[model samples]
Target chain A: MESVLEVKGLSKKYPSFELKSVGFHVDPGMVMGFVGRNGAGKTTTLKSILNLVHPDAGSVRVFGLDFMENEDVIKQQIGYAVGGVSYYNRKRICDIVAVTKMFYENWDDSEYKHYLNAFKLDENKKLKELSSGMKVKFYLTLALSHHAKLLILDEPTSGLDPVSREEITDIFTKLAQKGVAILFSTHITSDLDRCADSITYIKNGELMFSGNKSEFIRSYTESMGKVPSLEEIMVFIEKEEVVL
Target chain B: MGKLLKKEMKLTASPLSYWFILFSFMTFLPGYPILVGGFFVCLGIFFTYQQAVEYDDITFSALLPIRKKDVVKAKYAFVIIIQMISFVLSALFTVLRMTLLSEAKVYLVNQMMNANLFYLGFLLLVFAVFNTCFMKGFFKTAYRIGKPFIIFCIAGFLLIGVGEMLHHLPGMEALNSTSGTSLIQAFVLLFGIVIYVVQTLISMNSSERNFEKIDL
Candidate 1:
């Protein structure tokens, strides 16, 4: 099966933190949960794939195209949502939508409007005036409206209420049913269990596991004598330095 | 390229900076000379560019379906747009002054032309400064260097002032007078264009290298 996204040997170094060689891939029709700690390089990895942060060494291919060489084409097929999802403080929500619509060729205004209404967001409100959760909803609406084949979400559900999160999960599940791949990054294991088809865990900038969700959970259940949470498994891996 | 252009335009369409620039440019009117206009123009460019470079927006911008070259091109286009707007507005005010006051049209024209040249030089300098300071992962450095940069610019203006004061001493008048001639004016115009092109290329190369090296 063709992979929707492939990352290999991605490394980045900073004065205080270093993302060691990390690699992973997500096949089509899969919701790959990217689990990591607060500073475990998850955001950095996503940034690398989006060409937001330059990888010191390695390659990222999305939709069978080199990310750097074919960035525009890759971006066209990918939807991205960062943690905070900030917008111009002075712009009305509709204006922000309009600006985004102009850049994305596949933007669906009807879908965007529907999501805006679904989220109970006022089109006239300035972005700065919206609550943090509302901003995430707005970003998700924008991401979905672009007809993106892959959704790269970085802590997208962090601040949402359970109801809102469920609504968003339904959106992802629907998109996945239609064969859109999703790389949903979060520390929330329960959310991944609810929505992800597969799971990919990263620790200290290395892939810990990448496989079927049920099998991974079963394995953890068997080994730990209870179903270990994703966070526990990550801690175990870090303590033991488990390669697999 | 079109996508890049569109994105750049959208990014700049946020009206706050645009309005601020318009107001800053407008403040150079009524009784102000060309130096005030030039100062305001420089301030406007600095503020606008500085605001754009804040945070991960540049990273978000790089993530769009645009090439590194297109990113550089769009930035160049943005600079040109801002410069053109400020130039046009300043020219309009100068025209207003010429029409109403009627005493200093010739002096104002010459001063306006000189102001244009100074601005052209200022633009090149600012581009180079932005590239070396902000574009290459040195935004903090840029901010720090900015104070000294402004000091140096003031010092340079002071030297020009001193040179003007010495115009009566020797051959300085001849040099200043020749600066207004058709041939000399053409040379200055061409020099400005060449400098802009060269600085833009330098900025592009620097940005490309910076993008390549960035560990997003």
Candidate 2:
């Protein structure tokens, strides 16, 4: 199957930090986990692909079409659920949704209502009233309601409890099974191990690895001469770098 | 674009902005510098921008299925809509002052800028200055509102002072006319419209380009 998203040589430079030539791809029905420590350029990479930040160098293609040239069309099929940014904190959930739904041609109101019910979200409640975990679910609801083919989530399960994380991971697994590609960034490797089919690791603005999840684990296990979990592999590599 | 405009009016805008349009009624004040009425209208729109920043509205809009340019366009359209509503109100009040209240003692003896077509034109110029300065500066980073707003206030008030000073000039006495409209007043209103349109369009395009480079 053709890839749902392709990013090539994406580069962005800031005064104090720079994102190097980063690239990755996600296929339909695949869940790709983007892993990195803080300040590893994961957010920058995602922003560049979404055109929230203009890339200094490189190209991003969504469904084999140039992202910049076909941004509106591509964005329509992509659901982006960023973790921390809040929208209209003073407005009720229903009010914000009423404004948001008008922009999408394929908005599925029944699906939205279904997710709202499943998540136990109160439509009359202001966004500020929702807890952080609930806020993530709310963003996910907005993302899923429009029938997005690709979901780009930034740290969707960062601060959640283990049970909440499990619930979100189960949701991801089901979505991938339904042929929706998901690329999510997270520091929680356990979540990736649970649901991700592929893993892309970044270190200090550079791509350390990007491939099948088991292959990544196998490569690390062979090099270290023992079986290791995804979290162990990440910790071991990061510690080794610190020692070196 | 229409959808984006709806987003601005419904989601991002402050409700205080609508209430501020009532500031145009200040033209009915007897001896006050009625140009401050226009400033209040712009202040209302400024509050919307302030509220948008607090709500992270820019990032939210960036995530929508719209171009960065469309976001800037929607804001400019919102500003214009608010301004035009206030403008129409000021116009109605100016007509009232020039007609039924034309012979009222307070308006007749007021030494400040009289409620006239020239006042309407100067008000548009005030909005033009604000839009050109504020939009250009704000979009450079899309978050810094303080500096741009201060600069616009200086420019806006300077224009207001100049508008007040014009009638005192020997050849421009018709600018403060209360009872009758002059050819000069018509020309001033025409000139203000041209400036407002051209300035807003150029500055909006510049702001769109600036915003395209911002990383939300």
Candidate 3:
């Protein structure tokens, strides 16, 4: 299968924290769960791949193109959801969509309306007025409407209600079936249990494990001598990584 | 780049507040220096500069497919467009000032015709210096207002001081004469344009480089 995304030797340094040589890949038609504790380089890694942060040394390839060389072209086919930003607070939802639509080459207004209707969003509402869950829905709607081939979401499910989470998870499944690669970070491990085909777990700026989801769980069971839920497996892995 | 410009116009389009400032400023158009000076202050303080470093705008643009360099370019383009609007408005106000208050301010209109071309040139230089200063190290968006303002304040004062000295030169006829500006003032106007172009180019290059290194 052709990989939709690839990160190699990605490293970023900060005053108090450093993301040291982390790497991973996600193929087309696959949904990869990016699991990490708070400040474990999940957002940093994502930002690096997006070139939001200039990495100290690394290469990021998306759709077989070096992201730095073909950033504009590659980004057109990718949707990034950094949830619940209070950008343009004075602008209405309709205005935001209008402006954002012009940025993408393949923005679908009809598809956007369908998501707005399905999500029960009011286009006239200001961004400041939307609840956290509603904001995530808005971001997702923006991503999906752009006809993006790959969706990269950063902690999009954190404040969402259970029902909204389920709804979005369903949308991800549908997107993946349509051959849209997905890589989302979520603390809600159960969301992944039903959706993610692969998992990459990170801790303190290191990848603890990156492979098939079931194999990750089975590795935990084999090492710890018992089966555990995904969340339990995460805690065990972090603990083991710390001990090592 | 056109797409980048389009996105920038959309981002800066704060319908009410934006128009409100323009309307209010136009209502009280002042002399050459004050009119254009007020325009920059209002735009910098109330809109573009604030918007330039906005956390949300930065984050939002990062999600778009455009190059990091284009983001900086688009920002510069927006400021330039705002300056162009001010130019158009100033020209109209000059006409209104000359026609409506013709007899009372004959000198102002005369200045508009000849030597006062220096005013437009000076304003462009001031705005370029101001934006260039503000955009350098822009990623450190917070607590940076004072530095650039101070630098621009000195530039403003220096320009005034130089103009004052030039006005007193021995060969100079009265600066307020109805005939037109002297040859020296024309040279000064050309000089201002030179500085504007060179400074703006330097600023654009540096801002692009600094922004790429910034951890957004």
Candidate 4:
């Protein structure tokens, strides 16, 4: 398989918004940062790829296998973490894991225990008792414990403190080093700068760019006649569009 | 599907649902509208779905290595199990009312629906209506429960009212008999079981389709 994840011709329409043929691909061992402004269709595109939101038109391939046709098999190899995963506030972490681990045949109890200990997570704690950062760690722990070859995280670091964000990005870097392909959506460009090997930018439900992070930066410098941080490029484009 | 069903039972189901099975004993209550027992049992199952939504259970299930339709299937399975358990309890009380309490004056003179084989049939009808109306309506949005549940309450109670009124009709008094079963009572019981099975299967199919359109 050339790409760990590939999405093409993705489209969906709402009364007020439309995602028009968005496309992107992530190669194996690559950390691809999906960037977009609020309501820019980042979540929609990610959901479409996962078939959470049925795309009006598109095809998604994961590990070179058709996603829809081989959904169960494909999903087994993918670790999907939604932004704010609060499951049953009254249930303890071990109880939740007890229910979750049954679905995966390759569930690694030892790996789960390792992530639990490494993250300093108390398995006895209820979901409501955990802080926001701890919840993120817990979700990552679930995602990583199943021997996933691909990780798709939606806003994993949003609403987190700088320390927590740094910690998560560090984990992402290490995972990428171990050949686990990751596609993470975030508003935090700094996290991407720290770990992203490639970038995919969306604006108003359209694909603006999808390529090497340095190449995206170089393209912006050549056109604007100035070096710009990833954050600046995003802001500059949105601001420039309003001027037009 | 087995794993998903396990998740539904161990994770999403509420303890109140199991407790609500006791509602079947309302059959032993003299002169009261025992039909409401079936409605209360369904209400308990409704709480499970309500809690699932509050806890973002759909999103969690979506993240699992299973189809969205399988999530609906598991919920329906859990619901059927609860409903059947309630039905069995209600049937046991119905048998006692017919055999042991047949001559009890309070029951003999009761103007409401009697706990008999015919009543068992109507109880199944009540569950059938609940599964059809409530399950289909909830899956349309995959989140809202209040409206669908209210709709079920109306349908279920209306069925009970009809079941009670049938015994008052000039030629339908056999339906109110608290003793040995007649051919008509046996037929009604069989019919009720069929309706429960068929209606639930049809509702399950539509619910799975409606849930597929929902973007969790």
TM-score of chain A of each: 0.88, 0.96, 0.93, 0.96
Model 1, B1-216: lDDT tens per residue? 665566656654334435544643532333233344434444554554555544234555665666655666676666566656765665455444434544554444333223333333343444344343343333222223355346535644553454334324564443233233444434544665576567656766766665555544
Q: Which stretches of candidate 2 lie over 4 Å from their true place?
A: A240-244
Residue pairs in clash, model 1: A53-B216, A54-B214, A54-B215, A54-B216, A72-B65
lDDT measured at residue A105 in model 2 versus the true structure, 0 to 100: 90
Instruction: Give the clash total for candidate 2.
Output: 0
lDDT string for model 3 (A1-244, tens) is 6689998999988899999898889999899999988889999999899988889988999999999999889888898886555667666899888888888889998999998998899999988789877887888888889888889999878877888788778878888998999999876798898789999888889888888998999888877788889989877666654454
Which wins on DockQ, candidate 2 or candidate 4? 2
Clashing pairs in 2: none
Which 10 residues in a row give candidate 2 chain B its minimum summed lDDT? Answer: B172-181
| Arranged by lDDT, best first | 2, 4, 3, 1
Tell me how far the alpha carbon of residue A224 in candidate 1 is from the true structure, in angstroms, after superposition.
Answer: 2.4
The first chain of model 4 has a TM-score of 0.96
* Alpha carbon lDDT at A103, candidate 2: 84
The better candidate by TM-score, 2 or 3, is 2
Candidate 1 lDDT tens digits, A52-113 = 67778999988888877777777877888776667465568886677567667788888887
Fnat per candidate: 0.50, 0.87, 0.77, 0.79
- Model 1 lDDT at residue B4: 59
Model 2: DockQ against the native?
0.77
User: In model 4, what lDDT does residue A50 have?
Assistant: 90
Per residue, candidate 2 scores C-alpha lDDT tens digits across B70-140 of 99999999999999999999999999999998988888788789988889989999999989888788999
Question: TM-score of the candidate numbered 4?
Answer: 0.96
Over all chains combined, what TM-score does candidate 3 have?
0.86
TM, every model = 0.79, 0.96, 0.86, 0.96
